[model samples]
Target: MTNELPVISLFAGAGGLDCAVERCAEPPLVHDGSGSPLRVRVATDYDGTALQTLARNFPHTKTILEDIRTVSTSDLLKVAGLSKGEPTLVVGGPPCTPFSKSGFWIEEKRNSQDPNASLLDEYVRVVSEAQPEAFVLENVQGLTYRTHQEQLRRLITGLRESGYSVEYKVLLAAEYGVPQLRRRVFVVGRRDGKPFHFPPITHSGESERDREYDPSKLPFVGVKEVFDGLPATPENGEIADGTFGELAAEVPPGQNYLWHTDRYGGRPVFKWRSRYWTFLLRLDPDRPSTTVQAQPGPWVGPFHWENVPNADGEMRARRLRVPELKRIMTFPDEFEFIGDRREVQRQIGNAVPVELGKVVIRALMEQMGYLDPLGDGARPEQVQETLLF
Candidate 1:
């Protein structure tokens, strides 16, 4: 491996996977991974809004705003000022909507005909042409479901044919120290055909892991810790009027609509297990929150733990503010977004938790003989900025 790892991001929605690779560059971070910093040279995506956010956050990386299917890998490398096989890593999390658990409700999405399913091939196309030393592909856990065997198999076969060794796992974000319990599948490949090491689990909660491992392990991060000093005051502090409006307040912290069912002692307005778990869900300050969806319904939650007083002076639960959302998503506190409130939510929700990405890249760097994943050393300065844009 060279002293620097040049990275190219494809289908780079809000640069989440790129952010992870960059974090790995700053080795010896909290989870103990160390290595030479990664340089993000170019990012390509069709959504201009998301590209804008990625551009502003990573000003040095060249940004190409176009559908990937129309863009050739040669153009991607050229924009980054690199020739074929010059890049050290290519990282991206192709949009996973059609492969999501929620998409199953729309039966057309259950089949491979959905256009989004084909984007996985776009990722493989770049790996075949650009031929980076390594690559990482991320998507929803449902992509691994038996129903989607064709798509998964095609992805694996394409990479293997590209002269690489493939390894993957469904990673839990909370287990890597993120405040939310988001889960996704990460597939890694090395051109040399050597197996890759996924990072070790660095966090565990009392209930999630065995009791005996408790003493030496770090507990899973909770929402409270993530939002410690942020004020509950958001642009819209008033709770929106909806079916669960004032009623969300009735449910205590660390619970959801299940609290309203007969089994849990609320008003019993709902049957047992009647709705999605996120319905009327409130944050449990003491534990990790559930998966953060790209588009949550009006009554869906993991709402802020703090309650606000209504006109009658009674308290009511409120939605999470934008800043809180960014924190929970594991983006830096000062990170900026380029869209309106709703779009920003989608960007944050769709991002790969940055810290988790760092862990994975650390493992990749270690395989290349650059990391000390268990070291206590401090993070070094970022690599020289790639002024490709």
Candidate 2:
């Protein structure tokens, strides 16, 4: 029998989570002395642009460029060379916009004829049909909000009825070594009655409210820790060429346009506290970054705080370059993104943080007895040393 467990990925945008699962069975990150890494037999995604990016990075995997609704469990299993009872793991992050509080409310969207609302159902259908030994579903934390409790209940019930014991938690990416404060909900299910335990937090922030201070944990990585080494922007850094550019110049690091004053050259065109929190937001060098939005508007941000010397030697602000954003998302530098500027940003922003994914999958591996529980797995140093870029 093969030592490596096969994996089937769905809605695998840019394969950030897949990359993490793949690494669990590979070098420095590998916990068990397994002969080969986890085999990603098949991956499916509906977005052509995202599929292109996934195929580019994982050329060896059989990437199905089709909607998950149209693909059958038998087809996925056949492609993966697995039988009904074979050991396998299915992982995916369904489209979150339907349930994202940042977007539309789930209840309101459910009342409307939103096509994406049924995506969670489709994900459940695949798991039911495949009946894998275990499955992991990732989604926006809004799924667990009190207002969406009914939806959450139905989801858990549906998975349980499919013969799996499930547990879920909202995980902060920064606590898991990612340099961004992105919290995502992960639902893990095992058909064999085994309960899934989350991995312990490996990092903490200075703020008491951020997390309980633990001397054993590493301090949260700051924006400067990652961005300082990159190339500097031009003196008149490339601004967004509109009102955004005008407002961005006035906002300082760690603050948004809302903090702009009507003094000096700064013009306060926007009403104070009227704009969304993301507008003209700049990263703070000392703190972890805010969540990276899937589509950053001409004015909205998670923008960089990089300053360039203007003609008068004055410092000026500029929006972050795509590469800098990718780093914030925890993608390896060498990982290629194959799309136009907007499409690439969407793929990167929509991805699971690579470090977060590694932590989750490593926990699953240990739970399944595939790896030694006591093994020194998924250390930040090991991840950093093994990063291709």
TM-score of each: 0.90, 0.86
C-alpha-based local distance difference test score of model 2: 0.76
> Which candidate leads the pack in lDDT?
1
lDDT by residue (tens digit), candidate 1, 134-247: 998889999998888899999999999999999989998888888878888999999877799888888887433334435466888888887888875656544644567767
Q: Give stretches of model 1 more than 4 Å off.
A: 1-3, 25-36, 206-215, 311-314, 372-389
Count of steric clashes across candidates, in order: 4, 0
Please give, for residues 1-389, the per-residue lDDT of candidate 2 as tens digits: 33557889999988988877776643332223332246678899988888888888888778888888889889888987887757378899998886775655445664433567577888888888888889989998878877667667878988999999999999988887788888899999999887899988888885314546678888888878877677764423355554455567667788887676454235667676777888888888888888888887777777767655445665556667777777777776777998776777789889998778877887787666565556544233233333332
Question: RMSD in angstroms, all models?
Answer: 4.8, 6.1
